[model samples]
Target: MKNDAKTRDELIGEISRLSHLIEDRLVPDNGMTDDQLRSELGLLRDLAEQLSESETAKVLEKPAPSGRVESYQRIFANSPISFSENDMSKLQTFFTGIRHSGISDFRWYFEHHPEAVAKCAILVKRIYVNQATLQLYGAGGIEDFTDGLMSIFHEESYRVFREELIALAEGATSFEKETVVFTLQGERKDIYLKIMVVPGCEETLSRVLVFVVDITDRKDAESMLEEMRKMLIRTSSKSIDGNNSKREG
Candidate 1:
């Protein structure tokens, strides 16, 4: 049982590392198209899943961990909403540096240095993501999801993140906002995003939970209502104009 666990861990770790390597090799001049990368990474994900399923059976035959841990794992894995665990240590360090640099007005600094906000975003590292997140982002696997992570964020999303950064800088531990993101297939989605820094992990900013709720349908409905309201206004204005002309004649 012990050897089985070790072998499984090693295999998973090696596969994850290789996936990162492939991601790093992605450059404009690399001559590899997005489709090719997705195909290759999809194969890696299939192999990893097969190995994991085989090893998990053996691991389960042995004594499992505490009931609490098992329960948390179950809930996290099967959660309906998109949930992602992120390591923000690097971003935390960057925040620390910003403070040390004596930037009292973070808003001004960020506004003036918009690129810095973009840089801060790239520093966040994904630790884990649930299946819902994979489906939400139209990702075949975690590797493809993480590799194309930044591609999902657009200018509007960055505006929301800028608010998040300001909140974090002002010592807030949680934030929520309505933003937009794109799937791997380039479909725009309106999302309600919430970010919470796990209680004990606040100092290091190592573990953060992000929840994303798809709100596109609601937004679309609201937009339709607004358009109907405008049409009604136009019809009323035309009727009023015809009545006034008849009265004048």
Candidate 2:
């Protein structure tokens, strides 16, 4: 037990150190190579995983829960889908600026200015997430989950997702689309996302609620079915050609 505690403390210390390194390396003018930055992030992820295992074991060693803990235990802690709440005030402001400039699709602007999205990522924070989010993203806690947001999305998917989010913030009511998200362990999952803006009592947008459903299996099945259909069509065409040649002969 003493050794376990010592190891846990060491892991925590390493996690903190790596986190600082990651922050420093992410600066635009930072001199670190991409490989070096990725290496540090990888080490940080490993340390976080070890810490998570230790904490989970500790929780399991405790007695059965009661009261609020017991009541909350049955929530979406094990659900297959992910859900998150995000603040969209900054996005709304961005939309307002674009609308003033008569920009129909803000994607072009954002693509040209990658820093804009990064800035928005800092301002438009994700405030809450369900347990499934943490499990899906392999996050130890909400802080870890939020910190990994930029790295968790595929490049193209992130761009499209941002565009749609901006549109929704500009009074589009709701938005839904399929995109790819990367887990903390670097596994990619195709997800169907539904985003809705919740309005306050004053009839103004307050927060955005997002639902992320892992649709990787469904997408793969669809692709397989499409391939089978194309194959069947090709076979039928060949058979028809063969019969015609026999009739001609």
Q: Which candidate is the best by lDDT?
A: 1
TM-score of each: 0.68, 0.56
The alpha-carbon deviation from the true structure for residue 17 of candidate 2, after best TM-score superposition, in angstroms, is: 58
Number of the top TM-score candidate = 1
Superposition error at 68 for model 1 (Å): 6.6
- For residues 1-249, could you state the per-residue lDDT of candidate 2 as single tens digits? 456445544544544444344445334364644455345434333433443454432433342232233222333355344666676666677767877888877667777777777666555577677788888788887787454257686786667667775566445757777788888799988886776565341124346656676656545534533554465556668779889999999
lDDT of 1 at 244: 100
Any runs in candidate 2 off by more than 4 Å, and if so which?
A: 1-79, 92-108, 111-114, 201-206, 244-249
Clash pairs detected, candidate 2: none
For model 1, what is the alpha-carbon lDDT of residue 164? Answer: 90
lDDT of 2: 0.59
Residues 140-243, model 1: lDDT tens digits: 87677444247688889889888898888777778888999998899999997877776666778787767776767546634633554465556668779889
Cα lDDT computed for each candidate against the true fold = 0.67, 0.59
